[model samples]
Target chain A: MKKLTKDDLQAIKQEELKKETANWIKVGLSTCGIAAGAQDIYDFLVEEVKKRNLGVSIQRCGCAGMCYAEPLIEVKVEGMPKVFYGKVNKETAMKIVEKHIGGKILVNDHIYDIRSSQ
Target chain B: MQQKRILIKDTDLKKDRTRDFYTAFLTEIQDKKLEEKVQLVRVSDIGIYGKGLTVRVLPENFLYCDVETGDISRIVSESVVEGRPIEALLHKPDDKQLRLVLRNCGLVDPESIDDYIKHDGYQAIATILEKMTPEKVIEEMKISELRGRGGAGFPTWLKWKLTRAVEADQKYVICNGDEGDPGAYMDRSVLEGDPHSVIEGMMIAAYVIGATKGFFYIRAEYPLAIERVNRAVTQAHEYGLLGENILGSSFKLDIEIRLGAGAFVCGEETALISSVEGKRGYPRPRPPYPSVKGLWGKPTVINNVETLANIPLIMLKGGKWFSSIGTEKSKGSKVFALTGKVKNSGLIEVPMGTTLKEIVFEIGGGGIAGKKVKAVQTGGPSGGVIPEDFINAPVGYESLQKLGSIMGSGGMIVMNEDDCMVDIAKFYLRFCVDESCGKCAPCRIGGTQLLHLLEKISEGKGEIEDLDRLRRISRAMQKAALCGLGQTAPNPVLSTLRYFEDEYKAHIVEKKCPAGRCAGLFHFSIIEEKCKRCGLCFRNCPVQAVSGNRDQGYLIFEEKCINCGRCFEVCKFEAVSRG
Candidate 1:
C-alpha cells in the first residue's frame, strides 16, 4: 500500500462506513476471550458459515469488558435486532449460525445482551 | 410494517421468572394477533442487576424494571404497540457507566486501521495537524482537566506545557505501558483491544510536546498487548502516520516499542526512564523532573497508556465536553479492572465520582454467592482499602485519598466478608516487600520489617506493642524512601489498621482469626452430630488428617492436620467446622 494523504484517509473511512452496516458476526478474540476458548468458537463459526454458504461476514474483535461471559459473539443480521451471545460453546455457535442467521429466530437461553437499533 | 422487539430478562439472581414471563408475554402477543409484528427475546443478561423482571422494548428502547406478570398486557399494548413508555414502570437508571476511553474496545477490529478510522479514529490528529498549534493543543487539554490515569493524577496539559517550554534540539515522549498492579490490566486491554486509539493519542501528545520521537514502554509479560501494538505501529508507518511528513504536513513523529522486564518498580517514572535507557531500573530524586531532564537528560514527557488514550477524544470533542462528564477536579471516565468477590468480574469504565456502592452493587452485580461485601481494595499494592461503611463516598482523586486510599491505577478488587482484613494487608505488604528494589535502605529494610510483623500477627504470635512498631516502620519508609514503591507500600497496612483495628486486636488478644483466613490461628474439626458418615473429609484430606470409616463416622487428627482447610471445604453436610 502507498502512503496515504489527508484526502485518502477520509476516503477510506467513508468507504469502510458503508461496509460496516452490512450483516456481520463479531467474536471477542482478545486475551481474555481467547483464554475462554474463543479461538475454537471463531474457527467453528468460520467453518460453519462457509459450509452453509452463509453471506454473513465473520470478523474478529477484542474484549467487550464482560470477562465473566467470555467466548462472546455479537451477531447483526439485517432486519433483525443485533444481540450478543455469551458463554458460547461449539453447540451454541451452530445454533447462532442456523437459528439466528439461517432461521431468523434467536436461540433460547444464550442471549446475554441486545443492542437496540435506534 | 417495521417489526418491534421486546427483550426480557430477570435481573434478580435469587429467583429466575424469565421463562414464566416469556410465556406470559407470548400469550399476550398471540391474543392481540401481534405475534408477527412483535418478536420476544428471552435474554440471559439485560445489563441491569438486582431489579426483578427487566423488559426492554426495542426501536423505542424503553426499559421497564421490577416488572410484574400483571404488567405484561399493559406493556405490550402501551409500550410495544403504541411506541410509548409508561412513566410509572419506566426505569431511569442513574450513575450509569460512560464509555469514552473504551468506546471502540469490543466494537472494532484491533488489527484493521480502516475499522479504527471508520469509528472516527485519527481524525483528531489530522485536524490538529491542519489547524491547531502546540499552545492551542495544551490550552484544550487544560480545559479538559485530564489527569494521568497511571495513578498520580497529574494534569496532562501541564506536563506537555513544561516539556514544550524546554529548549532542546531533540525531545522525547514515552507511553508508560508497564502496568504491574496486582489486579489491574486496564492498560493491557486498551493496548490489545484498541491499539490504534492509543497510537492516535500518542500522536496528539507528540504534536503538543513537539517531540519527533516517542517510545511505548510496555512490559514483556503482555505478549498479546505487545503483538497488537507492534502491528499497529507497523500499520501506522505504512499509512504515513508514524514516519516523516504525516498527513501532508511537516509534523513528523516516529514511535518505537521498548519492553519492560516485569519489575513493579519500573512503573515509577524515574525507574522507567532508567529501564528504557539500557541501565538498571533505579529511580533518582525529583525536582529536575522528567519534563526538564528525562530520557538521556533531555526534555521528555511520559504519559500513561490510559492518559494518552484520552487525548484524541479530548481533542475531537472540545475540552468542555470532556470535562463535563466527571467530577470538579478529576475529569472524564476511568477504566477499572473490577475483580475479586464481585459477581461480575470484568473491565468497566465509569465516569469519575461514581460512588463505590454504585460500582460494586450496581455495575458489578454485588458480592459473590449473596455474601455481604466487606471492603474494597483500590490502587493495588501502593493503595489502601476502603471499608464497606464508606462505599457511598464518590470516587475522585481527593475523595479516595481522603478515605485513606488513592485511585492509583484502576484496580478495584471487591472484597467480601469471607476475606480477612489481616490477610489482605499481609498480601499487599508482601507484594511490596518482594518488589522493593533494594537501592534504597528505607524501602528494602522497612518493607521486610513490616512484612515480618504482619506474618507474626497472622500467626497469632503478635504482641500489642508490635502494632506500634508496624506504624513506626511504615512512617520511616514513607519519609525516607527514594521512590513511590516504598513510600506508598505501607498504604494497605495503614488503611486496614485504621478501619479494621478491632479485627487486628482480636488476633492479638483472643488468638482467633475472625475471617478464618489465618490457618495458624484456626483449626479444623469434624462435628460428630452434623456428620453423615459420608467419608468426604477422609477422602479429600490431602494430608490424611481425617481418619475414620463411613459407618463409624470420622475424627480429625489434629496432629496430622496442616490447617490447609481441605477437609473443611469438602464437607457438604456442614460436618467439618473451623474456628
Candidate 2:
C-alpha cells in the first residue's frame, strides 16, 4: 500500500462517509460484551442474515458503558428507529432478525434504549 | 408519514406496571386504526430510575415521566396523533453526562482504521503538523486548563513546556498505561475501545515536546488492550503516521510499547521511569524531577492514558471550548468505573463538578436491592471515603481533596449500609501494605503498623490510646514516606477515622461490631418465636456448631461457633439474628 498524503486522509474520510447507508447490526465486542457472549450473537446474526439473504451488515464495536446489559446489539432498519437490545441470546437474536428486520415490527421486552437522532 | 415508535418502561423497582400501560396504549392505537403507523414497545430500561412510568414518543423524541393509564388517550391524541407534547406530563430529562474523552469509545470500531478516521481521528495531528508550532500547541493547552488525569491533577501544558524548555540531546514522552488502582479500569477501557485516538494524542504530545520517541507503558494483564494498541501502531506506521517525515512535514516520531510486570508502585512516575530504563521498579527522591531527568538521564514527559486521550479533542476543538465544559480549576469530563452495590455497575462519564448524588441516584440508578447507600470510596488504596451526608459535594480535584479523598483514576465504588467503615479501612490499608516496594523504611514499617492497629480495632482489642496512635503514624507516613504510594497510604484510615469514629468507638468500647463485618465480635442466635424449626441452620453450618432436634429448640453453642454467619444466610425465615 502507498503512503497516505494529507489530501488522501481527507479524501478517504469523505468517500467513506458518502457511501450508501444500508441496514446494519452492530454487536458490542469489547471485553465486557465478550464475557457476556457477544461473539456468539455476532456470529449467529451474520450467518442468519446470509442464509436468509437479508441486506443487513454485521459490525463490531466496543463497550457502550451499559455493562449491566451486555451482549448488546444495536439494530438500525430503514423505516424504523434505531435501538439497542441487551442481554441478547440466540432466541432474541432470531426474533430480532425475523421480526425487526424481515417483518418491520420490533421485538418487545428486549429493547434497552432507543437512540433518537436529534 | 413515518412510523411513530412509542417506548414504555416501568422504572419503579417494586412493581412493574408496564404491561397495563402497554395494553392500554395498544388499545388506543388500535382504536385510531394506527396500528401499522404506530408501534408500541415494552422496553426493559428507559434510562430513568424511580419515575413511575416513562413513555417516550419517537420521531419527535417527546418523553413523559410518571405517566398514568388515565393519560394514555391524551398522550395518543396530542403527542402521537397531532405531533405535539403535553406541557404538564412532558418530562425534560436533565442528562448530567458529557462524553468528550469517550466520544469514539462505543461509536467507532477499535480495530478498523478507516472507521476511526471517519470519526475525525487523525485530523488533530494533521492540523498540528501542517499549521501550528510547538509553542502554539502548549498555549492552547494552557488555555484549556487540562490537568493530568493520572490522579496528581498537574497541568498538562506546564509539564510539556518544562520538558520543551530543557536543552537535552534526546527527549522522550511516555504514556502511563500502568493503572494499578484496585477497582479502576478506565485506562484499560479507553485503550481497548479507542486505540488510535490515544496514539494520535501521543503523537500530538511528542510533537509539542520536540521528542521523536514515545513509549506506552501498559500493564501485562490487559492482553486485549495490548493487542489492539499493537495493531493500531502498525496501522499508523503503515499509513506514514508513525515513521519519519509524517504528514509531509519535518516532524518524525517512532513509538514503541513496553509491558510492566504488574507492580502497583510502577504506576508512580519515578518507578515508571526506572522500569522503562530496564531497572528494578523502585521510586527515587525528586529534585531533578522526571521533566528534567527521566529515561536514561534525558528530559521526559509522562502522561496518563486518559490524559493523552483528551489531547486530540482539545486540539480539534479550540482550547477555550474545552475549558468552558468543566469547573474553573479542572476542565473537561472524567470517566469513572462506577461499581459495587450500585444498580448499574458500568463506566460513566460526567463533567468535573457533577455531584455524587446526581451520579449515584440519577445516573447509577441508586443502590442495589433497595439498600440505602452508606458511603463512597474513591482513589482506591491511596484515597479516602466520602460519607452519605456529603454526597451532594461536586467531584472536582480540589473539592474531592477537601472531602479527604483524591480523584485517583476515577474509581467510584458505591458502598451501602452493610459495609463496615473499619473493614473498609482495613481492606485498603492491607492492599497498600502488600503492594509496598519495601525500599523505604518508613512506608514498610508505617504501613504494617497501621494495618495491625486496624486489625486490632476490628477484633475488639483496641483502646482509646490506639486511635491517637493511628493518627500519629498516618501523619508521619504522609510527611516521611518516599513516593506517593506510602505517603497517601494512610488516607483511607484517616478518612474513615474522621467520619466514622463513633462506629470505631462502638467496636472498641462496647466490644460489638455494629455492621457485623468483623467476625469474632458478633455471634448468631436463633429467635424461638420466629423459628419454624426447619433445622436449616443445623444442616448448613459447616462446623456442626448448632446442636438440637426439631422437638427441642436449636441452640448454638458459643465455643464451637466460628462466627462464619452460614446460619444467617441459610435461614429461610428471619429467625437467625446477629448481635
Candidate 3:
C-alpha cells in the first residue's frame, strides 16, 4: 500500500462512511459477547445467510454496554426500524435471520430497544 | 409507517405489575381507534424510574410522565399527531453522564486501523511529530490541567516533566492497563473499544518524552483487549507508525506488551514496574520514583490506560478545549462502570462536577427495580461509601475526596436499602484480604485481623470495643504499609465505620443484621397464617427443614434450617418469614 497523504486519508474516511447501506446486522464481539455465546450466534447467522442467499450484510462490533443481557444482536432491515435483541442464543439468532431478515415481521419478548431514522 | 411511538412503564412501586403493563398499554392504545397507525411496542427498558406512566412520541421525542387515562387523549392528539410537547406533564430529566473516556466505546471497531483513522485518530500523532517540541507538548499538558485518573489525582504534566528532566540515554513510556478494582472495567472497555486511540496516546507520550521504547502493561484477565491491542500494534508497525522513523519524522519508537499475572497489588506503580522487570510484584519504598529510576534503572513515565486515552483527544482538540470541560481543578470526563442495583447497569461517562444523583437517576435510569437508593460506593475497594444524603455533591476529585472517597478508577456501585453498611465493608475488606500479596506486616496481618473481627461481629459474637480496635488498625495500615494496596485497603472499612457506626452498633449490641444479610443474625420460620398447605417451600428447601402437614400447617425446624433463604425465595406466597 502507498503512503496515505492528508487528502488520501480524508477521502478514505469519507468513502468508508459514505455508503448508506440498508439491511445490516451487527453482533457484539467483546468479551461479554463471547461469554454469552455470541461467536456461536455469529457463526450460525453467517452460515444461514449463505445457505439462504440473503442480501443482508452481517458485521461484528464491540460491546454496547448492556452486558447483563449479552449475545446482543442488532438487526435492521431496509424499511423496518433497527432493534436490539438481548439474551440471544442460536435459536433466536436463526429466528432473527428467518423472521426479521427474510420476512419483515419482528419477534416479541427479546426486543431491547427500537430506533427510527430520526 | 406513520411514525407512532408509545413508551409504557409500571408507575406503581408499591406493587410489581411490570409484566401486566403491556396489556394496559395495548388496551389504552386500542381505545383511541388508532391502533393500526400506532404500533404498540414493548421496550425492555425505559430510561425513566419511579414514574407511574411514561409515554414518549417518536421523531419529536417528547416525554410525558405520570400519565393517566385522562391525559392519554392529550398525549395521542397533541404530541403524537400535532408533534407538540405537553408542557404541564413534561419530564425535564437532566442526563448526568458525559461520556469522555468512553466517547467512542461500543461505537467503533477496535481492531481496524482504518476505522481508527476515520475518527481523526492519527492526526494528533501527526501534529505532534511534525510540529510540536517535547517541551511544548509537556507545556500543553500542564495547561490542560489533567490529574491522574489512576487515583491520588497527581498532575499528569508534572509526572511527564519530572521524567523529561531526568537525563538518560534511553527512556521508556508505559501505559498502565493493569486495572483490578472490583466492579471497574472502564479501562478494559476503552482498550477493547478503541485500541488505536490509546496506542496513539502512548505514541504521543513517547514522542514528547523522547522515549524510543514503550510498554503496554495489561492484566491477563482481559485477553480480548490484549489480542486487539497486539493486532493494532503490529498493524501500526506494518504502517511504519511503531518501528523506525514514522511519517518521514526522525523520531523512532517501539511498543511491547507485558502481561500482569492478575494480582490486584500490581496496579501500584512500583509493583507494576517490578512485575514488568520479571521480579516479585511487591512494591518497594519510593524515594527514587519511577520517573527518575525505572525499568532497568532508566527514567520511565508510567500513565494509566484512561490517562493515555485522553492524550489523543487533548492533542486533537487543543489542550485548552480539553481543560475547559471539567471543574476548577479536575478536568475532562470520567467513565464510571455503573453496576450493582442500578437499573441500567452499564458504562456511563459524565463530565466532572456532575452530581451522584444525576448519575444514579438520570443516566443510570435510577435504582434497580425502582427501589430507593441507599448509598453509592465509588472508587472501588480502595474507595469509600457515600450515603444517599450527599448525592447532590458534584463528582470532582476534591469533592469526592472531601466525602472520604477517592476517585479510584471509577467503579460506581449503587446500593439499595437491602444493602447493609457492615456487610458492604466486610465484603470489600474480604476482597482485599483475598488479593493481599502477604509481603508486608500491616497488610498481611492487619487485613486478616480486620476480616476476622468483621466476621465475628456479623455472626453475633462481638463487643463495642471492636469498633475502636478497627479504627486503630486501619490507621496503622494506612500510614505504615509498603504500597497503596495496604494504604487504601482500609478505606471502605474506615469510611463505613465513620458514616454508619449505628449499623455496627446494631450488629454488636442488638445481635441483628438490620438488612437481614448475615445468616447468623437472621432466622427462618414458616408463617402458619400465610401458608396455604401448598408444601412448595418443603419441596423446594435443599434441606428438608419444613415439617408438619396441612392439618397442622407448615412449621420450620430452626435447627435443620441452614438459612440459605431458598425457602424465602421459592415461596410464591409470603409464607416464609426471615428476620
C-alpha lDDT values of all predictions: 0.90, 0.91, 0.83
RMSD over all Cα atoms, model 1: 1.9
DockQ-based class of model 3: acceptable
Q: Which stretch of 10 consecutive residues in model 2 chain B shows the poorest summed lDDT?
A: B13-22
Runs of candidate 2 with Cα error greater than 4 angstroms are: B31-33, B535-566
DockQ of each: 0.69, 0.68, 0.45
Cα lDDT of model 2 by residue, A1-118, tens digit: 6767778899889987886366889998888888899999999999999999898989888888888899898999887778899889999999999999998888998888888532
TM-score, each model?
0.96, 0.97, 0.92
Tell me the interface RMSD of model 2, in angstroms.
1.7
| Candidate 1 lDDT tens digits, B383-427 | 999999999988889899999999988999999888999999999
Q: Candidate 2: deviation at residue B395, Å? A: 0.9
Expressed as tens digits, the lDDT of each residue in B394-475 for candidate 2 is 9989999999999888999999877899999999999999999999988999999999999999999999899999999999
Better of 1 and 3 by lDDT: 1
Ranking by lDDT: 2, 1, 3
Per-residue error (Å), model 2, residue B567: 3.4
Per-residue lDDT of B525 in model 1: 85
Give the i-RMS of model 3 in Å. 2.5
The fraction of correct interface contacts reproduced by each prediction comes to: 0.76, 0.69, 0.35
